[model samples]
Target: MLSYVRWYWPEEDRWNYDELDTDRWSLRHVELRGDGEVLAAASLAEALAARDSGGGGAVVTYERRFGVVPEAPFPPPDGDIEPVLETLSAGEFEQLWRHARNQLERAGSS
Candidate 1:
């Protein structure tokens, strides 16, 4: 299980990782603040590299661990989950999300 790890802090809207917009990996492990902290050698190396490159907030060596254990080899769910939604295209789901987001934003701004 080797993978790229990233951390996200919602309160601060900060991410302790490289620019995700430019990162090529579609599947990744994104650890949030609630996941808890951990200190790994790879995370330490990244912090060290950041400091060497003159980046701020790079001295911190701790990383957030997802603590997630997915099914071995990752299989689909055992039962039907909104079979109608499953039949829809990915773009339709995205559009639904966009609409919901817009509604929430408008409500918040009201």
Candidate 2:
């Protein structure tokens, strides 16, 4: 099982429970609710890096904690996303999510 996490808006300088998706072997989907608004959805690894990159000014960093994370279930992302980041489109995000699940299943030993 994967965990859901919330992130803050970097450029807008606002705090929102923005979400991210990570390669958790088995895709983990977290729907963030703001009173009742849907912010951007990102990966867990990106979120964490975005949080740290907040100080860079103007361009907020996207996708952090990647490339060296432990390879098991994967840890939750902090709140960062792609630079000049916008939420992933439904079709696009789902496609990636499905791919992650496929990888996890294939990696599993019968």
Candidate that scores best on lDDT: 2
What would the TM-score be for candidate 2 when compared with the true structure?
0.27
Q: Which portions of model 2 show Cα errors greater than 4 Å?
A: 1-84
lDDT of each: 0.32, 0.37
Q: In each prediction, how many residue pairs overlap at the backbone (N, C-alpha, C within less than 3 A)?
A: 0, 15
Tens-digit lDDT string for candidate 2 (4-95): 33334455543322223354332334322334322233354544455566744312433221112222332325524522334545555565
Clashing pairs in 1: none
Model 1, 1-110: lDDT tens digits are 22232334456553322111122222222222344332111223444465687555444322222212222221224633312211223444344334433543454467
Cα RMSD (angstroms) for every candidate in the order listed = 13.9, 14.6
What's the lDDT for residue 45 in model 1? Answer: 41
The deviation in Å at residue 64 for candidate 2 is 20
lDDT of 1 at 50: 56
